[model samples]
Target: MAEPQDRAQEREELEEIVRSIGRPDAFVLHEVIRRTGNEELRRHGGALFLSAFAAGLSIALSLIVPGVLKRYLPAADWAEVLVRMGYAVGFLVVVLGRQQLFTENTITPVLPLLHDRTLKAAWRLARLWAIVLAGNILATAAIAAVIAHSGAFPPEIQRAFAEISHQTIAFGFWATVVKAVFAGWIIALMVWILPATGAAATFVILLMTWLVALLGLAHVVAGSVEAFYLVLTGEASLHDYLWRFFLPTLLGNVFGGVALVAALNFGQVAPEVEEKKDADGTG
Candidate 1:
């Protein structure tokens, strides 16, 4: 049996946590921004840049795995599903490896900033976003160039890369942007849920990524692989990719991850927290 005071304190603490989770407004967004800003600052630019690069490089494995599966199961219609599962490989590696991924940053750091609404916090998030996006794009391009030129994969796999490139081109600008927004929303949610999952984080990461692939959603870093491959092969122009795919997807992702998911998450919790604070002050 618990003491009366102890039980009361426990109930209060639980209520506070629950209230925090329920709010989805500016205050909560500010909190998320501040917390993420602190985390980014603590990690520093070097680690963040390197981790983002690693995430890009590792995520390229998703492209490769699907190609390998395609080669092995060339005739099977369902093989695409199995091959697509390989898309989760890089996500698992990055998340479990504790690397900084840009999508995750979109929500994580913003929470704190939203809560505080300070100029410094806003600048921090802006800086982090710029660095992470640049690093991720560069890394993805480098890996894609290497894969295209290395001859490490068989001709069929190379052909598969071309096929993936063509498919991306077919999506056009708006579709890609819309798909990327959805993907970013899902990825942000994944990050939000991860801290609570303990050892099951990897499984959750896999499930989320697999869903992204299944839904034909676009991811900036991951999509860069296909875009670069096309550019390298002379099949698709860099101008087209940059204008049609990269820029739109980038904007959409930021909007989806930050505005739709993170902001809303903050909104939901803010009211409950305010109510609890009022109750405490009155008591």
Candidate 2:
């Protein structure tokens, strides 16, 4: 009886300790993200491009899954809500699969650049961004061509694809840009939060992506898949894709990731980091 009571009390104390463990603070999150950025900066160009291409190809699932959902679901009002959940599929694949995404690069690489600020660091960041963005765009273009030309899906599902693209691109240039900013901001915020989320990472990713889809936010790579599909299908012109969807979204995403996430976060932790470095005689 005495031994059993002691075990119970010990178990209760262990549970209390687990419950009382606190989440990492801003300084720790900043360090985690900064270290992640530094590692990415160190990767070779070919590896970065290959990973980014895989990410672009993987991200098409976000668009494709929604099209599938739209085709079979009822035409009821709540159906759209259910369909939006599919938007999270590709994000889950790319993020958790650890593929390189261009928008993610927008935040990850920027952290190193913000911290280092050397000409060499700036050059590395530029190279990383360019390679990743190009790989993502080219891969998305290829998949869009395949979807448009291949008879993989019946005409009905193809129509569903068209509908999704149309809705994504219908927001004019500025509106799409504004929405893209929110999308970028949310994605960057996800990156920042991920270092802290342990078992709930998948839920966090799904929730962030679903919010973007449900709110009609424009994501550069995912939206590119949609916009490129329209162009390849001859539903929209190359000019429309370049002008309305591509340019504005790229601009907004870069700004949102760099200015909003990288800048603000670095700013907040800068003083503390500098003070610590100075105290350690490393500054």
Candidate 3:
């Protein structure tokens, strides 16, 4: 009896780490997410915009939660670690809600293109990307403006927001791009892992997104909330928003998600896909 209870407690404490090793069947998972990407491409423009906008608005929790925590938590070695958990809250909402997040699009939609390799498929992927990216940016910009101008929070929380913005821009362009690459890689990896572990999706999202905040990596949508806040408050320039934050992070994210994760995973499964097609007389 004691042994079972002890194991249960251990699981509660270390649930995120239990399934760290061992991967799912890559080909099977690819097909599953590929179908998801296909469905996203077929969504009407209005529905896609609304979903992406919701995702942008939803991710605001990631920024706001950390800032609020920073304002209240006692400054200690472990305080920031605990505060970073807020990053997962926004991701949890975005992922689990099935909202159309742009970074997620970088990997999922590309799988369909890689498999189809047709002009029509490529065009659809590009269209989906453009709509989602535009919606995400517009929503984050709107929310940041409200946060900066609305004065809903106390001055202490506002200052915390400013500090977070300062940290986000402390890195130079190349440095931020590199960090964003890692951020993109992780986000795409999380998307890939989710279809495989339906039961552990929440833990995976929390662990991966929290890792982004803990490591101080640049994420295009989430980081833009801080950039917009800084710009709105006159602490940063519009040039800073474009040059210092947006451009590099976007490039890095696309490269990391499409080039590194999606392409490689597709490459691994391509031979098997072709083999199966030949076996079925569909090649």
Candidate 4:
């Protein structure tokens, strides 16, 4: 038999567990921002580069899986939906695997800059951006080379891959820029929603990335693999890849992720930060 005090404590614990059931505890805004910012600051050059390379390699799955699906699925009209679902595969690997994705940096690094507003912070941000972008592109180019020459899949699947790669850069330069902006916006929004998602984070990532694919928006990192594939196969010129897709989409992603999402969110929370500072000073 339990003592009365032990019984009361057990009853309280049971009630607390019942109340907590079916309710996931989401991360608060400031804690999420701080944690991400701190992690970025603490990550060393090698770690950052390798993680980015891994992400680039992994994100290629987005293109590869969809191509495989396109080759096998019957020529039904609705098969496109299944194809789009494949787009989430790489994102799942990148996000859940805790790799460094450049687009994700748009939000995470910006928070630290907002908090500090110093030239050193800006320089750190710039250095991180350059390294991650270079690593991602290098990893992606390697995948493109393999896909073009390694005889990794059936010729029909390779052809489908090439065809899908061409579609990624089919839009005109300005059109791709606009589309990439939307892509950046969606990606940044996904980053914002992630901290609050808890166990449902995978669902959020899949849904957002699928929407990105379904809407035909441009994503710089994932799109890099496709563009490189076209280049490797002689289907697209290096000049066009550089001028049309890579540069334009890169700029658009920066604008969308930084200017639109990070800046606005920071602005919304700026007042609360100031109030807290004032309170601390008085106390």
Candidate number with the higher lDDT (1 or 4): 4
User: Candidates' TM-scores?
Assistant: 0.83, 0.91, 0.90, 0.88
* Poorest stretch of ten by lDDT in candidate 3: 13-22
* Candidates sorted by TM-score, best first: 2, 3, 4, 1
Model 3, residue 83: C-alpha shift (Å)? 1.2
How does model 2 score by TM-score?
A: 0.91
Clashes of 1: 35
Model 4 clashing residue pairs (backbone): none
Best by TM-score: 2
CA shift at 229, candidate 2, in angstroms? Answer: 0.6
Tens-place lDDT per residue, model 3, 1-283, is 9966765665454334324423558887777677678768877999999999999899989889989999999998799898888878998999999999999998999998998788999999999999999999999999999999897998999998898878777888999899999999999999988866767789999999999899999899988888999999999999999999999999999988999999999999999888877898867
TM-score of 1: 0.83
lDDT of 3 at 11: 48
lDDT of each residue in 1-283, candidate 1, tens digit only? 4555665675565445435654444444344444444656445788788988888888888788877777778677588778778889988888788776788788888876765577987888888888888788889899999999998888989987777656666787888889989999999888876645556778999899999888888888888888888898788899978887888778878888998888888787766655755777831
TM-score winner between candidates 2 and 4? 2
* Worst 10-residue lDDT window, candidate 1: 23-32
List the candidates ranked by lDDT, beginning with the highest: 3, 2, 4, 1
Q: Return whichever of 1 and 4 wins on TM-score.
A: 4
Each prediction's whole-model lDDT (CA): 0.78, 0.87, 0.88, 0.84
Error of 2 at 4 (Å): 52
> What would the per-residue lDDT of candidate 4 be over residues 40-127, giving only the tens digit for each residue?
7657899999999999999999999999999999877699899889989999999999898999888888877876688998998998
